[model samples]
Target: MKADVVFINGEVLTVDKHNSRQQAVAVKENVIAAVGTNDDIKSYIGEQTEVIDLEGKSLVPGFIDSHVHLTIYGTNLLGVSCIESHIHSLEDIFTDLRKKAEETPKGEWVRAWGFDQLEINEQRFPTREELDQISTEHPILVIRTCNHMCIANSKALEIANMDEHTPDPEGGIIERDDNGQLTGKLIENAHMQMFKVASYSSEELSISMKLASDAFIKEGITSIHDAGAYGKGSETLRIMQQAVRNKDIRVRVYAIMGSLTNSHDFVHQMVQAGTVTGLGDYYFKLGPVKLFTDGSSTGPTIATRQPYTSDPKNSGIIYYSQEDLDCYLGNAHKKGFQITAHAQGDRSIEMLLDCIEKALKEYPRNDHRHRIEHAGIASPDLQQRMKELEVIPIPNPVFMYVNGDVYKEYYGERINVMYPARDYQEQGIVAAFGSDAPVTFVNPLLGIHAAVNRKSKTGQEVGEQQKVDVLEALRCYTINGAFASFDEERKGSIEAGKLADLVVLSESLLTIDSARIKDLGVELTMVDGQVLFKNEQLMRPSGVRR
Candidate 1:
């Protein structure tokens, strides 16, 4: 059969069930037509076929980011970056915020994202008083890297009606000074409420989604399990579908239903509407019922069984009681909705497992792929439970690279079990790697690097025994991710019948210096047999040869 496109003379990592490798692959329509040696695929290359030579670069399955916030990622891309690489001190942040405030009209909102208090020179969140230095007329909100917390100026707080007298809401915290005045720090639900007010309009959201989709293609991410949208989960799904309809967003999205709050009762609404997971087409599908068991891993609010090393009084925060969790998950489980929760800490993971185990006892579903978003600290017992329960751990190993030092101090020896990828592989558990973008950046290569190297950005080793080989890491990003979404058979590999989603890389990750794997670049990204992103400068020595 004549093919649409044929790629030859390169290292092709099919990332199939057996971890197969090929020399060439041919695409027909939206699926892979053939995968074999260059000579074997030559028969499919007709006169009209576009044949491109890879020279010596590498090709692999397109990345499947299992957990990411698309809306937040888009907003971050458009906002001023305050990440450690960009700003070193609070003064730098203030200067940027001031500039934004000056440009924005009075009484308008000013925003900045990705500030890690640990990375800043001051080593603490910028107080509300300091943000007031930017503009009292305009509300300012600076988000922490964790995305679970934020520091808002007095204006924004006043708009939220938060004061010392405003008691901390359930599953959230409103920090106050020793003198009982608002400190401007909002955690969990408090942060979510403020974000709701400061959120973008539908028009702005469409633009942001487009920008984020463009960036994802550049990074070779063809499919995304969008963790959740910003506002009401249902509304977020609608906006995402509209973006896909408008062709503003290109990546296949499996959208988790529900926001961080319980006020919406999205699960109840979906069940009432007779909806279940996997409810849409390939471009946009409704994923599992979403819930949060705990807060951010790096923020030290992951609800561990033991107290944090740095704070002996605090063992972290779990959002729901056992009865509440059981009610939420059990209802969804019986209703045929695959359930997933943001359970990062050991205690939180245990809580979720308890709920799942109880639900299974009452109504057993053989293939329920209930998932834990971070599974940040998976103890041996917890891993065994997860294995027996067939629970999926969507762990982000890249967290170690970005926040390993803090983890070391917070968890001490328990750090060895944090993101235990090797243990997951050995135990035959399907653990997918996610960036948890907007919490961190959305580069799968960095995740792979952290998984293989088990080292931090500062070269500090973490859980060395948990390191997996490059091939294992790739599967975690590709096939494992597909398995989590129950789409394993159709995509995630370069098999003949699979979706024609592939990425051409600047270097062979299999043979590259493991230390340098994160530096490997994407030369091209293809989705549904169409080249969506191509780096002209990196497209060296390639031509359509008849």
Candidate 2:
């Protein structure tokens, strides 16, 4: 068959077994037909083929963000802006909120995310009274960057019936003052009380998913492993599944189901209902069951081996009991489902590794592909266990960029030990990189740049010794990400008979200076022979010549 589209005069990094870099590539019906020198690919091009001169640009496999919060990111993008900007004080936060209120209609709930108390001068959660002073009528809720915590204005607390007498629920905390009055801060499952009352409609969730899909495609992301999917409603999941079936989604999604109040019952029902891991086709698939083992480091809520240097009274909170976790894993493993546990601190990582090791020994299933999402602080011994068990560690490299300052404040000299990506590599563990969007930015280049530089988003170095090279960072986003999702054979590289998911870049990342890597731009993104996003715009059929 004649080639449908041929890209010539380009540097193509194939990312194959040999790491072969080529000059030209030809595509026929979405699969790569040829990858070789310009003269070699020219034979496949015919009069009907559309030729694109890359102008000495670069081409590689479409990026796969191994961890992301699609629904949450979309909701935040539409709701309010709090990321990628400095809010130094309460005055600055109120200024931004007041501006948003002006644009938003009165009485409508004002939902915002990505606030970090540690980043602000006060280093404290804003109170309900502070927000009520701005607007008593509107229900304003601002989520912390961790997503494990949030602060609700008085209106929101009233709507949720949370008052001085309201008791803290299991697995969550409602911060209270010395006088036993609610302080507007909610952590973990307690955040759900207000969130349930503030949840969006199915229509709104659908819009959010569409918006997130568009954003991912624009950044050359053809596939993403949604880190957590919760409270978006069953209808929202159905809408996403249907969109994938109809080929409406431009990128593939591997969605990890969120933990529930009765997680064991939930996983049981989901499995019995015929939902299995790797259930669907290319566009959508059932990933692992997500469990939050602990909280975020910035919040001083992560379960650590030692007490925080800043907060002597606190160690951290555990979301699940040891018995509950073991039971959940055992049942899920029996049902042929993989588990991806969110563990950040050293203690949390160690506990989860123990559970996984015990479960594998008891269950003994081959190809389980169990993973630890955000194994940020693994000790040397734990690293050896991770490699021995072949468990995957999906780290958020973007966190290093966005939260390094907070790390310094909380852990002091221990900041280097946190987010040990280089250690994972040295121990021969399969470590993948992702941008936990909404907590950080969604751009993979920024994540890769942060991984390679070990520099914070504020342009300061945190763990200079742990820095990786550009090619290694790229593998974390591409090949290692594919391994995390079990899609290595079909995607993650440019090869014959594989799906034609690719990204065309304005510059060659391999040849560029490390400092300038973040400036790289995506010129085009293609998924399964269709142009999804092109040059900061959505691509339509008319613009693409087949």
Candidate 3:
């Protein structure tokens, strides 16, 4: 009965199927030895074992991020800051750009991210004419926080040879001023044109992936679903594959393959090569083939059925036609590959649902569990169909706090149904939550707060009725996330024989003020019976198991 470690005298919120609670947990090697009272668990401890006394603190399953771009996060850390902390006005953006521009060698491409025009002083997008002033010599590209749109200077436009004569790609737009001149803003696939001008080096990609893994350990995120992995054709896959071989993957990852244009081709490649989900072990695994049907919710590219309230003439953009999606996703589904799509607007969601329905009827597979990422804005009919078709909705509640006002501006009264967590739960549909990091912070606690609060940056409630309790919100991040990734049996909950991956919090979220939940800190994080992070200030002194 001896164990490697024992966490004793703690309030353990075992997010088990039965919703059980325990006072102690014993770990033997990489699995949970037992979950029981402090006295009972002590029986499994040995003299050489490490014992931690929780002192009534909170211990729960480690957070599993359902979606994230770790490589992008690492690269963004190295990029220039353009968020609110660095810029509250267009002037601040220019100032930051000017600094970076001065340091860069003339003609090289200068890149940055996390800029939101809604938060800037000008309260509008900066024109290409304005960007020319920042750097007429170097190609400057500043991506918005949404990552669905970006602004490029004259040099960048010239470098890519984008002009009025250059027509917009099928799923994107090249914004122009009233005079029919390039405004330097590229929406959706139009931003892909920049790839021809600038591409990230393999070293840059590897460095960022490592940096991102380290950051996840500190954040108590034990697992992540890399939503897009094959951008450069097996390059992303090889990077993570090498990470696992070198033990650089600090956290478990389920990488979803990225496709440039045709998802059908990507799936055909996988099926032909005998590549299927769960191809790897616990540390690294191949996940679903991810495809995008639309763009970001906070941005103007979500592809709605109705025009935006703020910009009445624009109804947003849908990236794929119904016939096109069916051809791609239907083929993938027929080949036994699960699909997770990014669809933010109602029309796009409808498109995916229709395709999924047709695929199931034609292929006749059960437990397909195909997911809809961001599923940000759904119609009542869409929700009902999601339930009937067994489609999983993976939504990021943090967007409510980060861009709630912008969502409200575009949605108007339709904001009532935006991110409807309570509805999903009550309707017997399993919904998972994610941070969609690099778009927003990767803090799961903040995600929980956003779900329970449903409040905006200014503390305005976007949808009071949509709020879920703290535990349900927690389940969405942990168990439901595990379910989404098909790892519920080994991870997710604290139960006997389960993986010893857990997080210790400074306060009990159940008893704390809802507002303070977001402020709570992770004191310790354990993966496979090893402590990865321990905050000395919050952890108690070691104790003898006896």
Candidate 4:
């Protein structure tokens, strides 16, 4: 049979069961027609086939980002960046937002994200009063890098009807001053409420979704688990379907369905509608029922069994009680919905495990593949429990690169066990890697680099004992991610029958220095036998497009 496209003279890292490497690949229609040496695939190429000579570049299965807030990441692209690398102080944040405010229409919102108070010189969040100075004419909302908290200027708070007398919402904190006035810091559910007031329009969301899809393809990510829809799952699901039909979203998505607020009702509605995980098509599918059990590790708000070393009196935030988790998760489990939650600390991990364990006892289902998003600080005991239940842990090792110093300060020795890629490997657990985009960046190379080195950006070996090799790291981003989404048989590897979702890298990951892995560029990204992104600068002269 004639192939639709042929890639030859490439180092093809299949990341399959045997960790095999091939020299060429041929795509027929939307699936891999063959994977072997150049001679093996040359026979499949026809005159009409798009034969691209790789010139010794590296080809691997396209990255599968197991967790990402796609819409949020897209919108973040539109907002002012307050990341430490971009802005080093609160004054810098004001400068950037002020510029954005001037460009925006009065009475509209001026938004920014990716600010970490710990990284800034002030070592504190930009106050609402300070943000108000940028533009009282426009509402200002600046989300912390963790996404669990944000600071809203007076105008935005006014729009949300939040006053000095506004009590904190359940499972959230509206910080107050010594005199009991609004400090303008909204944590957890309070942040969600602010989001409701500044929510994006459908048109805006469509634009952002397209932007996010483009960014994913540029970074060689062909499949992603859209961590949240940003509102009600049912409505968001329909919007996603429409986006797919409209050709706005190019990458494959496993749309995770749940809400941070009104979660019970969301879960009930999904169950009642007979929606379960693995629903929908190859391009888009319904993923797990997700819930947030705790806050972000970088925020130092993850519910740990012990108090953070930096704050003796605080053990971080747990969003729900064990009973509540059991109730919410048990009901979904009984309904055959694959369940997952944001459990980042040992305490939160333990709490979630209890609920999963209870659910299985009541309604045992083999190969459930229930997942723990972040599973950021699983201890030995927690790891044992995860293995026993056969639950997958989707850990964002990239957190180690972006927020490792904070983790070191807050959790102390816990850094060594945090993410724990090596431990997961030894225990035979299929742990998937995620970027948690907009929290960190969306590049899978960053995650792979962090996993291999276990080093923070500042040269600190945050978790030396937890380091995994390059091939192992690649597996987590590729095959292991596919396993988490139940799409392993169809995509994830460069096997003959698998979908032709592949990425050509400027450098071979297996041969690159661990520290330099994050620097490698994507030469091309393809999905369903179609090229979505190509770096013209890196293209070989002999690589001709049909």
Model 1 is weakest, by summed lDDT over 10 consecutive residues, at: 258-267
Q: Which stretches of candidate 1 lie over 4 Å from their true place?
A: 84-86, 543-546
RMSD after Cα superposition, model 2: 2.9
Q: What's the lDDT of the predicted structure labeled candidate 4?
A: 0.88
* Tens-digit lDDT string for candidate 4 (1-546): 999989998889999899999899999989998999999998998889998887777899999999998888988888888864768888888988888998999999888888878778899887878987788999999988888889999999999899878888877889989988787899987887777668777777888889999999999999999888456556666877788878899999998877755566677788788878888888999988878888878776889999998999998887889998998888999999899988998999999999999999999999889999999888899999999999999999999988888888999999988999999999999999999998888999989999999888999989899999999999999999999988999999999999999999997777887789999999999989899999989876668666
Off by over 4 Å in 3: 229-233, 259-272, 540-546
TM-score list, all predictions = 0.98, 0.93, 0.95, 0.97
* Predictions in order: lDDT: 0.88, 0.79, 0.83, 0.88
Candidate 4 lowest-lDDT run of ten: 229-238
For candidate 3, give the lDDT of residue 416. 75
Better of 3 and 4 by TM-score: 4
User: What does candidate 1's lDDT look like per residue over 319-420, in tens digits?
Assistant: 889998898878889999898888899999999999999999999998889898899999999999999999999999999999998889988989899999
Candidate 4's TM-score reads: 0.97
Cα lDDT tens digits, model 3, 260-353, are 3343456567766778777898889888876778877877788888888889898888777899888878877888888878888888889999
How much lDDT does candidate 1 score?
0.88
- The top-ranked prediction according to TM-score is 1
Range of the 10 consecutive residues with the lowest summed lDDT in candidate 2: 537-546
